[model samples]
Target: MRETIQKVGGRLAGMVIPNIGAFIAWGLITALVIPPGWLAELGIIGAETADTLTGNLVGPMLKYLLPVLIAYTGGKMVHGHRGGVLGAIAVFGVIGGAAFELSSGAAGDPPQFLGAMVIGPLAGWVMKQIDDFLEPRTPAGFEMLYNNFSQGFAGLGLTFVGYWVIGPVMSAVATAFGNMVEGITDAGLLPLADIPIEVGKVLFLNNAINHGVLTPLGTAEVAEAGKSIYFMLESNPGPGLGLLLAYWFAGSGLAKLSAPGAAIVHFFGGIHEVYFPYVLMNPVMIVAMWAGGISADIVFVATDAGLVGPPAPGSIFAYLPLLPSGGGAAGVLIGIAVGAAASFFVGSILLRMFPVKDMKDTDADADIGDALEHIPGISTV
Candidate 1:
């Protein structure tokens, strides 16, 4: 079961890692150009410039480009370039279906990322199966005709399925998940959310959860509240920082030696993925993450802390500009501090009790990247 989960996670990570650059570009553009963003707030760009860039670049990239990229990657994973092309073609139907649903008065405009992930691989597999059956039956002079027509027809059917079925289903699923989170917040049990979130982050569902689920809900909340705690839930760097700090101080050999660099990336650079391998290496350390996340969320609820926008990359630097002014800023800082301290204390104890065992026959001086390659289902990206 663990191996299976890791394989699934590795695939998911595979699709997203290649696209991290695009996500970062979109995030940076949004953070710098949106109203209350860094450039506008700093008086470096006027409101008009910010608005134009946002309207022309940010919204389309989020709505169209990102999901298509994900679908293309996923399809490529299943059946090479042909599968990728089909996947990209099919995802348009999903996007259109979602837009149609929204036009009927849906409360939120959730990005079709989840829909893309589902349809991309499905489209690839369908094309692969079609080729497997059709190739053997095609006549000697009809190879090109068989190949082109098979994929074209399959893509057309898949697109219709995506529009009529997959899109509506995925949108409903997104809505349901959002409503569930909203219910938790309404009941004053937002911290309880960390149970699934911390566990999911380690399993490499962090991006799917954050971008597919949380961001849409958080965006809706921001429309009413000017900020939303939903953005902080998965992206908070405190727990990962504390975990890496514990590893730095208490772990052994390669894991210990690599901790400081990973901590810097996870906390300051806002690449939270750098710390996931540590948790993967030491599954028990997830408890420390849970403790940290829940503890921080408690503070967030008490202080009503939130950011003006989602902090992409989730680094301390990404967080700085998004921080609300005055007490909210202090609250965000305090919560992060508390989370880190709590995670560090608990993680330290766990490492002392269950230190990461060095791999048998591995060199003591092996490079961290080389050592990571030996771990099953770990992605160093």
Candidate 2:
């Protein structure tokens, strides 16, 4: 069951990972162009310029460009170029249907990422199956006609299916998920979400959860509110930083020697995966991670902290540009600090109680690299 989940999660991660650049571009633009965004807040751009960019770039990119790119990538994953084309075609129907549904009085205008994830692969698979059946039966002289017409017909039918079926279904799913998050937030239980998130990061499902799940949900929240706590939920670098600091101060041998560099990368660079090996070497350290994540999240909720866009690398630098205007910056920094401190404190205790005995440098490095390679779209030099 674990293997099955990982495989599915890996595929989903694959679809999103390739398009991270697009996500980052959109994020950067949103951060700079929205009212009171960095540019306007800093007096670099006037309100008129900010408003113009928001309408021309931010709104359209979030609503159209991102989802289409996701669908195209997902379709390509299933059945190559042909599948990708159909997937792109089908996603438009989902986008249109969703727009129509939301215009009727829905409170928020959520992106159709969920619909794209579903229909892109579905359209691709359907196209592949059609090609498989038709290829064997086609006569030698009319291959082009058969290939072209079959895909055209399939795309047409799939677009309708996307509009009438998948779009509404996925929209409902997104809304349900959104409501669940809101309920958790309302009850002040948002910190509890860190448990699964911290565990998943250790298991190499970090990208799947952050990019595939949290990002879409966060984007929806951003549509309603200027910023979203959902964006900070999984991407916060504090817990990982705390864990590495513990290893640096409390660990022995290579683990100790390596901890400083790892901490630097994990915290400032925002590549949280660097610390996973430390936790895996001593699973007890996960308790520390949970403690840190939960502590920081509590502070986040209390302060009403959020980011205007998803921080792609989960780094401190990536976060700076997205900080909401006003007093949100203080809350964001405090939460990160709290998380790091808590994790470090707990992680130190865990290391003292259960030390990672020294292993050969090559063995430790290989083990870490091998573990990382199991995650989708990651490879170590």
Q: Judging by lDDT against the true structure, name the best candidate.
A: 1
Off by more than 4 A, model 2: 99-106, 188-190, 193-293, 300-331, 340-381
lDDT, model 2, position 26: 73
Whole-structure CA lDDT of model 2 = 0.74
**CA lDDT of 69 in candidate 2?**
87
RMSD of each: 6.3, 8.4
Model 1: residues with Cα > 4 Å off, grouped in runs: 99-106, 195-231, 240-289, 302-315, 322-325, 341-381
Reference-based TM-score of each model: 0.72, 0.63
Instruction: Tally clashing residue pairs in candidate 2.
Output: 0
Cα deviation at 86, candidate 1, in Å, is: 1.2
lDDT of 1 by residue, 215-237 (tens): 77789998998888989998999
183-291 in candidate 2: lDDT tens per residue?
A: 5544667798787777767654454455545677678888998888888888999889989999989997656766787687667666675676677666778899999
